[model samples]
Target: MEALLILGGAVVFLCAWVWLAVTSRRLPVGLFVVALALPMLTLLLRRKGYSRPARLLLLTGILISAAGVALLYREQPEQFDQLISGSWVTQPSDSALSGTLMQQPFVPNDVRWQGKHLIFAEKAGERIRRSLVVKFDRAEALLQGTAIDLLPGDTGPWPELVLQWYTGALEQPGLRRLDGGYSMSLALAAQGPGQTEMVVHLHLPSEFGTRLTGVVVIDGQPQWLGKSAAVPEPRPAPEPAPAPEPSRTWQEVSILALLDEPQMYVGQAVRLTTTSGKEFAGTLTAVTDDKRVVLALPQGANQVDFQFHPVDIQRLQARPRQ
Candidate 1:
């Protein structure tokens, strides 16, 4: 989104520059674009010169030009934070939602332009260790209601029921996950915890399968949701690192911003990457006058080596935690 904004600004600046070159000396670049594009567009006016329709169209363009500039300089207000947190998920004696989304009243699966990450409600405690998807915003949400987690098994002897959940049937409230347990074709269950449920059909890797059954909560509202997932056991706590003293700490910038810098001094180390496929750690090795960057191999780096790419790369992040 920011990239698009920068690009649009550059295009406008370019038109202003070109207009300044061709127009009369008295007008500023801004005024030139506002005025020049007008006469240039006169050819589009089919009516004869000084005609009523021609004057109306020209006046209309001037009005639109003023409106456009007003919009360009306008600072829009911050967005409403629709992100849900806390008991919205876990405490549901009055409700069972522990995560976002379900914590809020279901308002018809709405339009969310900013977006979310992780099926928080479904994932609960799962960690996305070393992932390849790049997303700067780690906003999470959960689709809670009911779901069926399916697991695989062999032949009639075949597999884990946890690998299977009947959700296709819940989509329209008429679909089903067949109980006979073997057909590729699914069947609907006359059963449900509500008039509608958010069904998740888990297709496990072809090899491993585990035990499956109704996901029952020991404490909170014992929701008889379709399926359950094995909450991943938390890892043993690692030794904590010393927090940086404020005096020694440095401000951080996004990799995108670092790329916009006209130059990088030697030994200028910066952090990049985020939960998304962004670069979390890297050093700026070189920079060009055009505001493009060259990232160096990271300190003690043992993974993929940095390579040359002619196009502008947006992967390296330099955002520092405050």
Candidate 2:
């Protein structure tokens, strides 16, 4: 009975291991092999009459197999859920299945490439410069582009890349076919005088019709390239500097002290408080020779001057124009 139980457990574990190894794209090969070997070791222990250790080994194998399956499901929960529900399986000969796949493509939710804009970026020091602007047409199965070599600090397009077919055809005006997501070469014109013509090679691979992955080679040096938004976002203009704070210091002086050199305070503003506790503020329009002060106050759209004599004024404070 013990042997039968051990054999059944081993068989179940093997079936699960095989299913996982086949279904999971991210299953570690070494770990899969180790997990498979554990069950076999358990079987060997059973044959050697180490019953208790064999049971523990069997249990450990079962746990490892369950953990691996759980990890695979967690990696892509929706995909596993569909697989468990048997919704992913479709008969290859069914014409209706093809239409269904096209109408509802199986794009992973985490994939940001599908239906999203793509551009090429080149890292220049701390700044990421836009190098190429291209869009993938999945239905057409081609990459269309307008490529340019932008200088470090230029707002306008710099020396552009002149693309030509491998057959030496001249580049067509406007957006053109750059690559078919396989292999292509771009013949770039010499950016400056006394320089030779340059060719840029690109190796872009289309994976699952969602991402554009590749390497760009310039002058025999290969660099990694990926899809990014090409247009640089408009940076907000820096906020205007706050106005300087005004001086809080004020000098209390007699009305005559201001009238002595009235030219200095002619266009200045004044805040006056009378002995009767009345207050007025306006532009110091004029100071009469009669020791009477004239203040121009705004009434509606016109300026009306108010005259104050030396007796009516109690406290006078003067400040220059801001």
Candidate 3:
């Protein structure tokens, strides 16, 4: 059916081009034929009488191609429809399937099965509820045929993967928890008879963050587990500072008066070093003007994002400058 559509459109375009070329130069409208010959197939028009064979042929070609385009459109309406994909799981496919799955209480954080949406935190899980729609742009639409509607379901358990290959970016696997300012990445997904497995990854970018990878399975009718989304790239692990050896067993020092200025001022030139002795060059912001020194880490310095003032200056000095 799709092939026919393309064939019909090609035929129509070819016919129009033939008719226009034959009538070229004789009629003013045949000038349109000249433009049509462009590699881009543009259909610019110039006023021309229909007297010339080329003009008439071009007109005939235009009509034929238009009709062909319509014919092609008629053959693939399903590709343009709202509901292109669907799935249903009457029973859980977890290896640990237990009747307790059916007995799980309807708690907000708990996943509840209701033959429709899997209600998690009172929100619909695409796998357990109505299908989600994803609409791509023109180029993507051409490749995948309009918008696609797909269902999200349990493809496997945690440490396992919950795969969703359907319609919307929002419905994509790693986005559900993004609402809570969290993100995830998927590693793998597969299914088995009476069993399914999925592997997921999660990363928290905030302070004291962690990266976790694990698999999960659902073998019962109703299973509710706090499933983390897959992390795209484990936030590059914060580089571990060199471990302190026994010889380096030293107490920390203070920086009471290391700068000429009493307190860090906005736009004040500053040179500083961390307790770990990392050097930094930056300007002070409006904040931390009192005792706190808000040092802007260099552009690409993330893990070394902030700097604070040391209460005492006994140890942080420049080692008494030669």
Per-residue alpha-carbon lDDT of candidate 2 for residues 1-322, written as tens digits (9 for 90 to 100):
3234344556665565554434433545654454445434434432333234434544565766566546545443433444455655742221111111112222111111123223333222222211233343332211222221211222332222212111111322222233332322332233344332323223223331222122222222111121234544444323324346554334465677777877877776677765434456667877787666787766668876666655456787766456
Runs of candidate 3 with Cα error greater than 4 angstroms are 1-6, 26-75, 80-223, 226-322
Q: Pick the winner on lDDT between candidates 2 and 3.
A: 2
Candidate 1 lands at a TM-score of 0.19
Candidate 2 wrong stretches, greater than 4 Å: 1-244, 248-251
User: What order do you get sorting by TM-score, best first?
Assistant: 2, 3, 1
Residue lDDT tens for model 1, 1-322: 3234444544554454344335434555554354455544433444323234433444454455545444433321111011122423443242222211212221111111112211212221231111111111321111122321111221132221211111221232111222223211111232344222222122222232311111122222213323334444433323225456653343554455444542543245544332212233345566655443455543343432232222223234232333
Angstrom error at residue 69, model 1: 54
Q: How accurate is candidate 2 locally (lDDT)?
A: 0.41
Residue 215 accuracy (lDDT) in model 3: 46
Give the Cα lDDT of each candidate: 0.30, 0.41, 0.33
**Per-candidate TM-score against the hidden true structure:** 0.19, 0.23, 0.22
lDDT of 2 at 176: 28
lDDT of 3 by residue, 1-322 (tens): 5445445555655765665555454645535454455512333333443224444454555565566445434543322231223212222332221111112221122232233232222112323221111112211211121111111121222121121222332343322221112223322223444433433233333431323233454333322222333424323223325345643322222344434453433444445543222344454553344454555544454423343434211133111111
lDDT of 1 at 1: 39
TM-score of model number 2: 0.23
Candidates 1 and 2 compared: the better one by lDDT is 2
